[model samples]
Target chain A: MIETSHLSFTIGDSQILRDVSLSILPGVVTGLIGPNGAGKSTLLHCLAGLTEPSSGHVRIDGQDPFTARDDDRARMVAFLQQSPTTVSRLRVEELVAFGRWPHHRGRPGPEDAEQVAKALDAFDLEELAGRPIETLSGGQKQRAFVAMTYAQDTPWILLDEPLNALDPRHARNLMARLATLANEEGRSIAVVLHDINAAARWADQIVAMKDGQVLAHGASRDVLTSDTLYACFDTPFDTVPHAGRKLVVAT
Target chain B: MRPWVGIGLVLIVMILASLAVGAASISDGDGGWLIWVSRFPRTAAALLAGAGLALAGVVIQNVVQNRLVEPTLTGTPEAAMLGLLGVTLIAPGLAVAGKMLIAAGCALLGMVGFLALARRISPRDPMLLPIVGLIYGGILGAIATYVAWQTDLMQFLGIWQLGEFSAVMQGRYEWLWAVAALAFGLYLIADRITILGLGETQARSLGLGYEQTRAIGLVIVSVLTAIVLVTVGAFPFVGLVAPNLASRWQGDNLRANLPIIALGGAMLVLGADIIGRLIVYPYEIPAATLVAILGAGVFLWLLHAAPRRA
Candidate 1:
């Protein structure tokens, strides 16, 4: 389980997150939805130990994730930043192999290579393994990066704006993969998604935020209501039932 | 186009040409012993220094994650030049090895200082770091030029400025071999250095000590720059050109490209040296001048040929 206790953050003169507290359970897909500049990414960064909080603390499985060793933290939580800085000139396989760095350091044995191969297969990247990352299309590159994060094999995966450059097909495929990982593999995933319906249809839990604070958070059944959506984004939303589930439609 | 194969072919051709041409051309050997003692070492010096400079440039580019970075442009070569100047002034009779040692030490210090300044300003901006380095290089070059002019050491400094393999003979060229060995050490640690190119956060998350690897890379660059300074003075952008060429084929995996880049560097220097010798005959232009002209032309071509991201 991942827990954040009164975690607050400020940069320069602006407060990005304020005394926010939340707990995420295992085997659930937690969707973080918020308006622009709502501190969703910032909070994600803090949880992944990419940035230090101003006060309070974040813990993953009872250990301060921020201060934990790289290998330990990597094993517990895998973080995929929005628009990850790609290392150009590297092959897709080589980039994926880096996900195993925390485990193998520089020397890779047969087992590590096997895991890399599995990740490539899992993300449908085997065909593009030898191709340089720079040669891939935007969607392909995003898949390569996702494959890398998946190759890390952490129990809790955190992604920020993962669907930005992906097309509908790729986006839906990725969400399905995440859903499968959550249900079959019994792992937790926290994703900051822009598509409300995608979240409503796939996410087991939803946490809404506006202006650096949580507006509403609960099971998808309660959190995906039109009132909560409007309050979170300051825009009107209509709800419709589809396949016996709530789908939020923007007005 | 496989850059490694191209570089190897060029290096081989240059090696053959270097052995064949000189003041005492292989066709008419004034003394067999003279060729062995003098010309052979000079050729070796050019080859070693060229390879070292190229490898150093590759490492620096990877560390700073910028293509524009080079030892001469990054202030290290100028700092080394100053070290040579200081040694010449303080101990006029100092041997070439002593001068190179002083140059290496000073270059290391200069590189460290530059990195510290870069970190303070903007660690993430690749362009900013190289600009600061270029400015620093200019200041050091100015100081060296002024001092050389005042002390009537202008001719000596000028010869150093326009790199020539003529100064290198068997006995005087051992320093370059040491530099080549240092370059090999860099190759051994190339993986660690490449990891650093991924930015600090990513590198650290991968269990690498970013600061330490960066420092080690800088130190290696300093030593390479210093050796090149003492061996052939300053040679425009062989360092810049070779690595980019290597990257075109090898894709930034330093370990895979090390030999290719080294050979490419050797080919560039030797070919320039040979062309200089052939064009002017008895009145040879400096090898450094030829390198500048050739390197710039090739660099322009690379600008067109370079892949978008590599």
Candidate 2:
């Protein structure tokens, strides 16, 4: 479990994240939804221990992630930033293999290769394994990055705007894969998503934010209500049930 | 692999030709002692300097996350020159080693400054970093030039500015051997260096001490540049050309590509030196001038070549 207590982040004179406390449970897909500049990405970075909170603390499995050793933090949380830069001429398989770095630290063992191969297969990247990441299409590159994060084999996986470049098909496929990983492999995933309908349909829980503070956090059905959506986005949103899942639409 | 074999053969021919063609022909009866004293040392100096600069280029590129920028373009050589000028004026009696230590320290400081500036700019325009570096180097070079002129050390400055192997002798160039040890150390951490090219967040998330690794890389680059500047002066373009060619032929897997990059650097510099020897036949031009001419051409070609893969 990942928990934050009165977390706040400030940069110079501006407050990016206000005092916010939340819990991310294991074995579930939690979606973070907010408008632009709502501190969704900053919050995600804080949880990944990539950014330090100004006045509060975050704990992952009872250990402070901000203060943990690098290897220990990496073993517990894997983070995929939005639009992660690619190293030129780095092959897809090699990129995925880097996910095992915390485990091997440069020297790879048989288990590392096995995990890398499994990640490639999981993301359907086998055909593009030997290709350079720069040569892949946007969707393919996104898949390669997702596979790299998956190969980290961490208990908590955090992604910021991973679906930005993905097409609808690839986006749905990725959400399904994350759901399966959460359900079967028991990984806790917190993904910052721009697409509210996708979050409503796939996310086990939803956290709504606006102006650096959480407005609502609960089961998808409870948090996806039109009133909460309006309070979070300052825009009217209609939520309807479709095939036993809530579908959110701008109205 | 076959192409590499071909390149190896070409390099061997060039080395032999460089050893044979000099002010004094190796066909002379006294050629054995002359080759041992001057020709071999000169060749070794050129090779080591080339390999070191090329390796330094790769590390700097990865650390800065910019392919177009190298130490030569990034004010490193000029900063080292300034340090050398300072030591020359303050402690003219200092040994070459002392001078090198001071120069390396200054170069490290300059690189850190460049990196700090680089952090503020976006890497979206690949050409921007090199341009910034060129201007930075120019300002430093102007300061060094003013100091040299004021101190009446312009003659020494000229020699440092135009890197050449003509002055290298058995005892004069042994300090460059430090580059070999530095390169070996870099190889041991090649994987970490490659990981660094992934940028800050990913590298940190992968458990790398990103700032620490960048500092170590800068130190290596500074030391390498200092050694070369102290020994052969500044040879522009070898660092940029060698690593760029190697990356095009192979990939960015540092461990797998470093040897090839080193060899390519050695060959290019040695080839330039040989051409300098034979082009005028005993009235030799400086190898540094020849490399600048060739390196500039290649650098231009690289700029106009196909769009970058990244």
Candidate 3:
């Protein structure tokens, strides 16, 4: 379990995250949704140990992520940021091999190779395995990076806006992959999403934020309510039942 | 791939020619001994320094995540040059190895200062970082130039600044082997360096120690540059051009580019050294100055070929 208690962060004088306490359960997909400047990314960074919180502590499997050694923390958690920048000329296979760095440091044995191959196969990147990342299209690159995180094989995966440049089909495909990972493999996935409908469709739990505070967080059914959506987004969003599933639409 | 292979072949040919065709002439066994014992050290120094500089360029580009960044462009070499100046003034009678160690130390310190200043001013704006480094280099270079002018040692320092392998003999060039060793060590850590280029957070997520790896990389680069400066004088752009060329064809994988970068750097220096010898026949121009000109031309071509965002 990953937990944050009374987390507050500031950049200069402006408070980016304020008095936020959250618990992310394992074996579930948690969706963090917020409008622009809502500190959704900031909170994700805090959770991933990319950002140090000014007030509170974030613990991943009971160890402070910020202070934890990279090898120790990497075994428990993996983070993928928005538009994950990479060295352009690295081949897909070599890029995937980077996931094993924490496990073996730099020396890759036969087992590491097996895991790398498995990651490529899992993400359907086997065909493009030797291709340089710079040559791949936007969607392909995103898939490759996600595959890298998957290869990390951590219990918890945190992704910040992984679907930004993806088309609808690719986006849906990525979400399905994450959902499958969570349900079948018993891994925890926390994703920061700008699209509300995807969150409503795929998220097991949703945390709604507004102005750096958690406005609502619960099971999908509770957090995807019309009142909560409206309050968090400051706009009217109608939550309608479509085939026994929640559909949140802004009007 | 063929072009790179061809370049490699051509470089080997040039290296042989460099060894064969010096002012001493090949017919005389005495001249042959001069070539083997005296000039060969310079030749090896050229190969080592060239390859080392290019490799350094590649690492710097990756570390800063900018295509245009190089030792010369980013003022790293100038900082190294200033270090050389400080060491020369403070301890005029110091051994070459001692001078190199001092230069490396100062260059590492300068690099740290640059990083600190960069962090303080702006984290993401790399354009500012190089500009700041350049300004720093200019100030340092100016001080060095003024010092050289004031002291009767101006001519001696000027000779060092304009890189020449004319005086490199066997005993004088053993220190370069240490640089070659440093380059190999860098190759071992190249994967981590490339991973760090993705960003600190990404590196941390991958279980790589970002600060530690970066510090080690900068230190290695400084030491490599310092060794070259002390050994072969200050040849600019072998680092920048070699890495740039390697990236064009070698896929920017540090491991993949290791040998390629080394060979490319060797080729550039050897080829330049050969050409410098052939031109003006008996009166030899400094190999470093000529290569810098060639490197500048290639650098411009590379600038044009680089991505717009880079």
Candidate 4:
């Protein structure tokens, strides 16, 4: 379980996240949705222990993420920032294998290798395992990063705007993969997304925020209603049933 | 066999040629004695300086995560020269080891200042960091020039500015052996250095102490540059060319490629020195000038050739 209580983050003179309080259950995808500059990314960073909140608490699985050792924190949560990259020509397998570092430190045993192979297979990256990551297309690169995160074997996975450059087909495939990871492997995922429909189709729950505060928090069906989205985005939105789920549209 | 083995054999051949191709006459009867005293040390100095500067370049490039920037471009050599100038004026009687220690300290300071400026730069523009470093280095070089002129140590400054191996002797060039130890130490932690090229957030996410690793890399670069400067003046482009060429062949699995980069550097500098000796015969050119011209060509080629992200 991931929980934040009265979490507030202030940078210099501006307050980025204010008095945010929420709990995320394991084994489900939680979509963090808001308009631009709505503190969604900042809240995700605080939850991942990458940034400290000014005057509140963040706890993952009953432990303080900020105070835990790096080894312990990495084991508990795997956080992938937006489009993280390296200059060196690391092959896909090598990059994914580094996810096992916190576990084996440096020396790799059979189980670690097994997990790496499995991650590559899971992401369908076996064909590209030997290729340099820089040579891959953007969607392929994003999939490689996701494969790396999955190889971490952490209970909680946090991602920030991972679908930005991906086309719709790649986006759907990636989201479906995350949902499978949540449902089958029992990983808790929190993804910051700009597209409301992607979140509506794949996310089990939604955390809506506006101007640095949570506007609504519930199941996707309840939190993604037309009224709630308008309140969150300050724009009119219409919800219509499509393919057994609602598609959010601008009006 | 690995490609570097072939490169290594060629390097050995070049070392032999450098041993045979000095200004000494073939009729000089004591060739063996000259080998023990002059030729051996001079050849060794070229190889060691080349390896050290090249290794220093790899370290800084990884630390800053930019291939275009290296120790010489990043105010390191100029900063070491400034420290040497300071010691020459204040304590002219100091030992070479003592001068090297002070020079290392000043080089570290200069690198720190350049890193601070680099932080404000957006990494999207790969050209910016090295350009900033060039300007930073130029400013420090100007300061060193002014100091040397004021103290009438311009002659010493000139020698340090343009490196050559004509004066290396057994006793004079032993200081560069520290680089071998430094390179060995770097190899032991090559994995950590490789992680540095991943930028801050990813490195930290992988449970690396990012700042600490960068600190260690910068210190090694400074010490390595200072040692080379104190021993054989300065060599340009040794750092930039060798590692890059090595990478183009073998990927950046740094642990596996560290030796290749070092050897490539060793061969390049030794070859340059030999060419310098033969260019004008008994009236030899400085290896630094030759490398500067060659390195500038490679630099331009790197900038415009295919425009891959460095």
Candidate 5:
């Protein structure tokens, strides 16, 4: 479980996160959604231990991420930040292998190789394994990076906008992958997402934020309502039943 | 069959040429004295400086996450020159090692200053950094030049500013062996250095101590720059051109590619030094001049090739 208690973060005079307390349950997919400047990214950074909050405390699996050594924190939590560096000249497989760094550090054994190969196969990146990341298209590149995050083999996986460059099909495919990882593997997953319908379809829980505060947080069915969406995004939102599920659309 | 094997052969030939071809040619029965005293030291200095500068280039480029920026462009060499000038004026009786420490310190400060300035620029655009480096380096160089002029130490400045090995001898150039030691130390942590290219958040996520690794790289670059400047003077683009060529041929697997980059740098400098010696036939053009011309060409090609290569 990743828990933040009464968290407030400020950069100089501008506050990025307010007195926000949130609980992210283990073995579930939690989708974080809001408009721009919603503090979703900041909160993710805090959870990842890449940022220290000005006030309040963050505990990941009962230990403070801030105080844990970088390697130990990485062993426990794998975070993919928004727009992570698109390194050129590195083949897809080698890039994914970097996820194993926290495990082997530099000396890679047979087990590390097995994990890397498993990660590549899991993400269906076996075909592009030898290809350089720069040569891949947007969706393929996004898949490669997601595969790297998967390769981290951490119990908690936090991704900030993993679907930015992906097309609709790829985005749905990625969400399906995350949902499977959370449901079947029992790993906790938190993702910052822009697509409301994807969150509605795939996420078990949802957190809606606006102006640096959590406006709504609960199970998807409870929190992903038209009123909550409208309140969070400052726009008119309509939720209509489509087939067996509800679709969130801005009017 | 491997590229490095071919490069090794080429390097050997270059070393032989460097030792054999000089202003004072060795006669049949010279008994290795000239080779040990002058030619050997000069050849070794060239190789060490080239390798050192190349690794420095790799570190700076990875740290900044831009291929175009190198130590010379980062105000390091200019700062070292300024430090050396200060030492010359204030404490002429100080030891060479003392002067080097001061210069290395100044180079680190200069690099930190540039890094702070770099924080302001949008890092997404890689081209902007080289321009910023050039301007920042130019301002530093101008200040150094003005200081040298005021102090009438322009001749002293030229010896350190324009890198050449004609004056190299055994006892004088032995300190350059530090480059070899530094390069070996860099090899051990090359993976961490490579991780730096991933940018801060990703690198840290990968369990790298991002600030610590970056600090280590900057210190190494500063020390290497100061060592080269104080020992055999400054060479412009050994760091830039060597690492780019290695990356182009071998890719960004820096742990495995470190030797290739170092050797690539050594070859370029050794080759340039030979050409400099042979082109003027004993009169000798500065290896610095030749390398600047060649390095600038490679740099321009890199700028033109960045978008196309991707």
Candidate 6:
């Protein structure tokens, strides 16, 4: 389990995350949703140990991510930042192979190669493996980056807006892959999403935020109410049932 | 593979031509000693300096995330020159190794300073970076020029300004071998350096020590630039041209491309030295002047090609 206790992050006099405490369970997909400037990304960065909280702490399986060595922390949790940037001339397969760097630390064993092949196959990127990332389209590049994150093979995968620049079809495919990884493989996933409908449809648990504070946190159906959505986004949201899943639409 | 073989053949031809085509005839009496003392050292210096500068260029480009900025553009060589000027004035009797260390330290600081300034600028217009770097280098160069003038070291400054292999003798150019060792060190960490091109956040997420790795890269760049500067003066654009050309041909996989880049650099410098020897026919133009002329053309072509590539 990854848990944060009374975590607060500040830059100079500006507070980005204030008194936020959250627990992300294993074997589930937790979607963090909020309006712009709602501190969702900051909280995600804090949880991923990319940033340290000004007060309190974050723990992954009872160990503080901040105090852990980089390789050790990487083994425990893999983070994909929003708008992930890569070297232009790097090939898709090579980029994904970098995900295994924490495990091999530059010396790739057969197992590392196997995991890279698996990641490429998982993301349907085998065809593009030899292509340089700069030559790929937006959706393909996004898939390549996600495949890289998957190849990290950590117990906890934290993605900050992995769907950026992706079309609806590609976004849905990515979400389905993440959901399968969570449900079948028992890996924990915490994704910060701008699209409310994606979170409503794919998330097993939902954490809603507004003004640097948690507005709601519970099972998807419980926390994704019209009232909580409206409060978090400062806009009216209507939740309707579709095929036994919640479909959220802004009104 | 065929292309590599072709390049190797070309390099061999150039090396042989460079060794045999200097002012003194290698086939004449006492010519073997002349070849050993002058021709061979000059050839080796060209190759080593070219390889080192090109390697340094690739590392600096990755570190700063800009292909246009090389050691020459980033004020690295000028900073080293400034350090050398200080050492020459403060302690004229200082050993070459001591002078090199100080220059390398100064080059590192200068490169770091350039990067710090680069961070504040948006990378939208890529050409702006090199222009800014050129101006920054100009300012530094001006300062060095002022210091050299005040100290009556104008002739020394002039020699450094235009890199020439003409003066390279057996003992004078051996320091460049340190760059060869450092280039081997660079090869070992080639992957880490490539990861650094991914920017800090991605590098950090991949369990790479971003700051430490970047510092190591800068140090390598500094040492490489210092060695070249102290030994055979500054060769502009070899670093810039070789890596850019190699990346264009082979992509940015440093592990696979570094050797090619090194070889390409050596070839370009060796070629320039040969052309410099033959162009004026006994009144050789400096290798730096010819490289500048060739490099400027390629650099402009790169600028024109960049938009399409992007």
TM-score of each: 0.88, 0.98, 0.94, 0.96, 0.98, 0.97
> Lowest lDDT 10-mer window, candidate 4 chain B?
B301-310
Off by over 4 Å in 1: B1-10, B26-31, B82-136, B143-160, B306-310
Indicate the worst ten consecutive residues by lDDT in candidate 5 chain B. Answer: B301-310
Per-residue accuracy of model 1 over B220-242 as CA lDDT, tens digit each: 88888887887778888888899
DockQ of each: 0.39, 0.71, 0.67, 0.70, 0.67, 0.62
lDDT of 6 by residue, B68-152 (tens): 7789999999999899999999998999999999999999888888888899877766777778889888999999999999989
Worst 10-residue lDDT window for candidate 4 chain A reads: A81-90
The residue pairs in collision within model 3 are B53-B239, B54-B239
Q: Which stretches of candidate 4 lie over 4 Å from their true place?
A: B25-27, B306-308
True contacts kept of each: 0.34, 0.59, 0.66, 0.59, 0.62, 0.54
Model 5 chain A: ten consecutive residues of lowest lDDT: A82-91
Q: Who wins the DockQ comparison? A: 2
Once fitted onto the true fold, the runs of candidate 3 whose alpha carbons sit more than 4 angstroms away are B1-11, B117-136, B151-153
lDDT of 2 by residue, A1-251 (tens): 88899999999988989999999888899999999989999999889998999989998888998789998899999999898875556889988999999999989999999999999999999999999787788899989988999999999999999999999999999999999999999999999999998899889998899999999998999999999999998999898889999888898
The chain B TM-scores of all candidates, as shown, are 0.90, 0.97, 0.91, 0.97, 0.97, 0.98
* Candidate 6 residue pairs in clash (backbone atoms < 3 Å): none
Better of 1 and 2 by TM-score: 2
Q: Provide i-RMS per model in Å.
A: 2.4, 1.3, 1.4, 1.2, 1.7, 1.6
Share of the reference A-B contacts seen in candidate 4: 0.59
CAPRI docking class of candidate 1: acceptable
How good is the docking of model 2, as DockQ?
0.71
lDDT of 4 by residue, B1-310 (tens): 7765787688889988988998885348998888889999999999999999999999999998899888888999999999999999999999999999999999999999999999999988889889999999999999999999998999999999888888899899998999999999999878888878877776776777778889999999999999999888988888998888787777788888899899988888888899999989988888888888888898888788523567
TM-score comparison, 2 vs 6, better candidate:
2
What tens-digit string does per-residue lDDT give for candidate 1 at A1-251?
78898988998999999989998877999999999899999988888877889998999888897678767887778888776664336788888888887777778899899999998998899999999887888889889988888888888888898998999999999999999989998878999998998898889998899889988888998998888888888899999989977978889
Docking class of 6: medium
